[model samples]
Target chain A: MMNLSRRDTLRLGGVAIAALTIAPARARAETEALIKEFAGGKTPKNAGLTLDIPLAAENANAVPVTIRLDDRFSGARSCEEFLLVAERNPIPEACRFKFSPAMGMADVTTRIRLAESQTVVALARMSDGEILVRRVSVTVTVGGCNG
Target chain B: MLNRRTFIAAGAATVAAAPAIAAPVAVTSTTMLKPKGKKPRIVIAGGGWGGLSAARHLHAQGADAEVVVLERNPIFWSLPMSNKWLIDVLNTDYLLHDMIGPSRKYGYELVQTEVTGIERDKKIVRTSQGQIDYDFLIVAGGIRNGYDAWFGNDEKAIEFTRRAYPSGYTADAEHVAIKNKIHNFKGGTMVMTLPPPPHRCPPSPYERACVMAWYFKKNKIPAKIVILDPKPRIMPIGGGFKAAFDELYPDIIQHIPNAKVKEVDPFNKKIVTTAAEVKFDDAILMPPHQAADMVWRADLIGKTADGKPTTWAEIHPTMLHAKEDPNVYLVGDVMGAVSKQFGYYPKSAHVANYIGKIVAIYIAQRLKGQEVKTLLPDNLCYMMVSGEPKEAISVQFDYEIMPDGTISQKQIDIDIRSADLVEEDHKWAQRMYGDFLA
Candidate 1:
């Protein structure tokens, strides 16, 4: 048997589900499931994060996206980890970023692939066991994920 | 058992099994080479571009010597024209050739085994099969990508992420990994990174990015590729590639210099630099590279520009032999020969091919009790900038050996990136491949 890691299986599983009409409904369920996977089902507060991306991406490929933990909610003492998710991408969970005290700030910018127009979410975990959420809706005229 | 060439040409159904040998003693001097029934044997470690070139050059009709080549891989895959294949501009089959055929054709024995250890004093190469003694040794085993250089990036993480974003510099399978991503990508960011210099083919990352952008444009795929180069600006063929990026892929390709990938959060598909944290849909992360493992294991390393221990073998600039041992010669990407003309003799196929030829001549002459002549090898590199008809840029390197044994270097850029040079690049590949195989 081919060795497929959990992440790879999830990615492959996500694409396989896209073929069925259950996608749109399952996408919403998967988003919630992913948030729970990262946040452990804790109700996350909606504050302290600025998820900056284009409202309308001109190019589906190479859309510059940035997420920053504001000074008020910044520092390793306050913020422990960050996770980025595209609600509609074939693989909805983009990445999870962990920070240490050595890191002075919590700011990240990277381009991501998208399957269609969807809301991009950022979840920041607080040292006080609190999870904060920020979401931005972007219209991608051209879809980014073939799957 | 069928030779590796036949196996590879036969679709590499299976790799030839390693041969068993009894406890083997090391041969220390050339005198031991004159055995009762055998001739002097020259063993070339690494069946890469340089090793093959040396084997071909050393092959002479009725030469009173035995030549043997030891390569780890069962099949030979050329890295020169790989970018063209990745971007669907050329056939992928052209990238691979059978090494065993060439070695057998030129009367050299090709042993498909990994060289595990080397004892220079004893003139012995320890392979997975067994220990093989040699009169003269040429080490051209090439480079090992330094995935450790990136903070928080381990070899396992790099290997794990490679399935998603392949660093197609060494492994042929990585090309297929990235090629599939490119074809399957609906639209999204593709991240390609360039490690610091002293890597194989300095212009390759840029060339790959250019071809990728071309692929997006030609296929009408709404995609973008971001190139993160550690250097301050584009390197080696910088002007040519930059111009092509500006004129051809201004919208599709983004070149960001001095943006090193300091740390990678592979679990999240995120890369962190001092400036920003980058997320990618797909990526081709080229980690920093060093000389092959055996070179480091043998303690054949030198120093780099930053006074850090070099990942490459430091060798005599003119002689191509290891600075520490005269009998051991280092060629190709593994050598750390500094040159005034081309800084540290940029690791390119052309430069390695030239070094292999020169090293072969010097070693052959030395074996015959002839005075060895000082050598000055030229560096030639061609980079494909466009896909259709394949317009390319040509770079020529010239160097003069200073009286104090240092080199003074000069660079010449020929007729700008055009269709003519593409022909030249193709011809160069044909000639090099011919020299290696035919």
Candidate 2:
């Protein structure tokens, strides 16, 4: 038809506008504060965990996120707890999932609301007193949390 | 003189104001007001469920007020039973009605013209035909698709939203497309998305998913329905929807809560959510909804907590009249979610029909120069959860109008897929249609 490549760029531009308007600077700051509170000043190591989340999303309200712990890579007998965080949501903490030794694997999947294009962090706590972290960047084009 | 409590308890209410099981009655031409002075005219925009009810009720009350309805569609289609059409359980004849016959029989003038502008200062609606004056305006002009909210007024995005992913809320031609898509589906992922709350018929998406699941099962298709819900849990009917998924179609449908849609590429049939990017063989992508453009252009939209203008018209709960312009009344899905402060009422056709009657009584009383007391009509809803004719749930809500003018309702939870309620659902629809449209 018309110039296919130009049309594609225009389409991408539309999505970009949606992301920019949804997560302004103030929203990002709000999420950062929540992240600080959740961390409680403990330094999170970038090891022993994987955060599986979309790099970009069409809908802001329901983003699928998965957190998996690397039991073989680290010195952890068992996984105790896991936390999912959205860096710029009104409420940055998406959810908290607890795990027991009987479960064997510490993996959780759920949908979370994202205000804008921000980093999603997954934190996992091992029984051996180690905290592992992973971050994934997500760009949301349409907002779901319109009050 | 039936109060709110009695109205709710009596499932199918024929109150003092509205008589039930009545055939569609038209005001005789002899009874028409031929005033020595200017005749009082009531103009209802959007001749769908709510607008038609208000027009019919005004006629039934034997009011001297001249009633006129401005509807854009040539033939009337209902959002209520249209779902049955999508699953091939109901035909177009049942889904579509002759608007001309109803307008002529009811003695109300029906203009098959689009309402282009609302001239509030002059109390006239600027239509495609011409400017028509009115003494009172009833705005049942339903939802305007919130395409801007999703994709920043992108023409391609808006086009894709409307044509590619048919929401089937308006019962337009796209509804048939959705049905055809489902029927010809070759057994893969059928993605159905729900916008956040205050969308027309809260239980509809869940109902549609269950029905789609039934279609897949009945046809022996190897497909699954994935519902991406913007809310964290099942809303409005709540547990009833989840129970339907668990008991009837658990193997066929999977509901993911709090999964709001972020982006949709209709060209590629791809939808990206906060959770995952899903490619589907067929999809029903419902964008967020707003009141018709007339509500916004007339400066009738209210502000939300986020300081953004509301998607629907702001109206007083006691009488569904616009807060911005009292003479201009709003009903049906076009009315905002005032339930947060006023009371809990789902945006459904039945609730809208009830609101229309209440407005009619108020208008008639006012026309006679008599004071009309505040009224609280029960919000009644009957949702179909299965492809089978006899599987549905009926919800009834009663409210207490507080001294401050807000409503307080008692939560009545009923089990899902009740056969008795399903029978009531059919009877209720028939009587309701007979009461307003015959």
TM-scores of chain A across candidates: 0.76, 0.68
Q: lDDT for model 1, on a 0 to 1 scale?
A: 0.73
Distance (Å) between predicted and true CA of B438, model 1? 1.5
Q: Please, what are the lDDT tens digits per residue for candidate 1 over residues A48-146? A: 788988787633444558888886444435678999988777778888888774676789877776666788899998787778899999986421100
| Interface RMSD of candidate number 1 | 24.4
Candidate 1 lDDT over B1-438, as tens digits, reads: 357545454442122322232114442233122222278888899988889888888884234578788898888888898888877667866778987678768878787778888888777877766677888888988888787787444667866766666677784577777778777788888887777766778337888888888888988888889888776556555557788999999999988877878787666878887555679877888887789988986779998679889677988877889898888889888988565323477688877787888788788888787877776666667788888757988766555565556664445445258987877777778877877776
lDDT string, candidate 2, B1-438, tens digits: 457645553532211111211223433322211122267889898888889988988887677877888888877887776766678776777667777666767778786667777879978776654566789999888877787767896898788668877777774787888888888999988888887766777337777887788888889999988888877666555557788888888788988887888887777888888877788877888887778887877678888788988667778866678886779998777887555432225667766787788788889888888887666555556667777655876555545554444554433435456777766656666766776777
Candidate 1 differs from the real structure by a C-alpha RMSD in angstroms, to one decimal, of: 21.8
- Which regions of candidate 2 deviate over 4 angstroms? A1-147, B1-37, B342-344
i-RMS for every candidate (Å) is: 24.4, 20.2
